[model samples]
Target chain A: MEAIIAVLLILMIAGSIYTLHARDLLSAIVSYGIVGFALVIIFLFLKAPDLAIVQLVVEIITLIIMIAVIRNSSKEDLQERTTVKVEGVHYINLRSALYLLVTGILCIGLFYYFVKSIPGLEPFGVHTTRMATTYIEQGAELTGSANLVTGILFDFRGYDTLGEATILLTAVIGILTILRIKGKKV
Target chain B: MTLFVLCFILFLVGMYGVITRRNMIKIILGLCIMEYSLNLFFVLIGYVKNGVAPIITKGTEQATFVDPLPQAMVLTVIVIGLATTAMLMAIAIRLYRKHNTFDIREINTLKG
Candidate 1:
């Protein structure tokens, strides 16, 4: 399982790099979808299934919106755009490349050091699992809920989940308000 | 181990699109790809060695319950995914009509 997961990560990285360089519109969008899906899987391997689900759902919604907007799009060569020429315009260039590279390297380094320093991480997970099992053994008394996950999501982390839901709702509302055909000012 | 890496690679590819792609549709597609790979990863997370379905009954007295929470959440996630997709598609359609062109470079009326 670990080996398989590793391989998946490698593929995801490669895809990301290719996507960065991709010039075509369709291919780039498809590549983004692929990347989102890959991240979902990676989250699973990390034992954060909830995060994975959230990522998957959010990504799908975003993709659909994008597709609908660009369904009738036509490719054309537009005039060359300049960053400095347009005030307050952020354009892509070699400087952006440096930022990306720095961020990527920093993330990689942080992950490596964090893992190396975190000892007995397995034991920690085992402990969490054991705690959950304990709750299961004493079900009904702990949270008055049969489903532990539900309890975990809705009870222990209720506030956090509520926040997430709110964010999603806000995004949906924002999208609707922006794209509504009634022509009301957003 | 390798699978984890593969998933990461897929994520990176999507990132590539997100970072560099200029077309609206392509950006959306890139987002979708990233979402998919992440979902796959999550489903795999709940899997246990030789684990069986979470259902339990008298017939399978010795059966072990695989964590059902992840699967349940996944179902919900799928629905949400569809909803978001619909919304996105609607926006894309509207944008295309308004701009009359798909090239993001041409639709530069929106200023940052």
Candidate 2:
């Protein structure tokens, strides 16, 4: 299981890098899709079937929307643009490269120290779940829902779900308002 | 443990993309990747060894189940991500229509 997860993580990293570096817009989108699907697999392996299902569906929808947006713009137009120029020099110079390297190392070092400082965290699994245990043991009795996840989502944390629904609705409305064509008034 | 570190690395890669890339779509993709890495990290944090799914079935005896809170939360996060991605894509499309390009460098009409 560990080896499988490690492989998947490596694949995800590679896919993201490819997505970032791909010159062509279509290929970049495809690489991003690859990363999304790998994430779905990782979720399944981590025992989060609910997340896996939701991620799979959302990944497909996101890919479709991105592709549709890409289809509207021409490839040549997207490629002809250059980076920000400073005194006739491109932004991707030695200074920016060194800055990126230093920042990456600093962030990784800090994260490593923080992870080491945390006590009682096992290597692979065995997380101590106080609330989760309570939820599992008394969830059915409290909410009368067979699935504890469903019960928690709809009954226990219903307000959060409601908020998420509202956000989705607002996003749809915003998209419609932004994409609508304006008629000229003579 | 190692998985968490790798996830963080992925997040950093996304950050690098967002900071360095000049294309608007690539930046959006970087943001999406960051979101995915964070979601994965949260789900992994809730994993238990030899754990079954959180769904309860009749006449089944299970001792351990994965934490359902992160799963539920991630479900909401995924939907929220979809909405945000849609909005971002809409804005990107509008930008393209106005500027005829997706490059962030050239869409600088507000530069003083």
| Tens digit per residue, CA lDDT, model 1, B21-110 | 555655555565566656554455455555444333345435444444555455455555656666666676666676665556556766
**A67-92 in candidate 2: lDDT tens per residue?**
88888587532433335588987675
Q: What overall lDDT, based on C-alpha atoms, would model 2 receive against the true structure?
A: 0.83
* DockQ-based class of model 2: medium
Whole-model lDDT per candidate: 0.56, 0.83
**Chain A vs. true chain A, TM-score per candidate?**
0.58, 0.79
Per-residue lDDT, model 2, residue A166, is 95
lDDT of 2 by residue, B1-112 (tens): 7787788888988888887777899989999999999898788888889988888886544568888998989889899999898999988888777767788877776342
Q: What ranges in model 2 sit over 4 Å off?
A: A76-122, A181-186, B109-112
Candidate 1 per-residue lDDT over residues A50-72, each given as its tens digit: 56667777767666655444455
Chain B TM, every candidate: 0.83, 0.92
Q: Give candidate 1 misplaced runs (Cα > 4 Å).
A: A1-69, A75-176, A182-186, B57-59, B100-112
- Which candidate number maximizes DockQ? 2
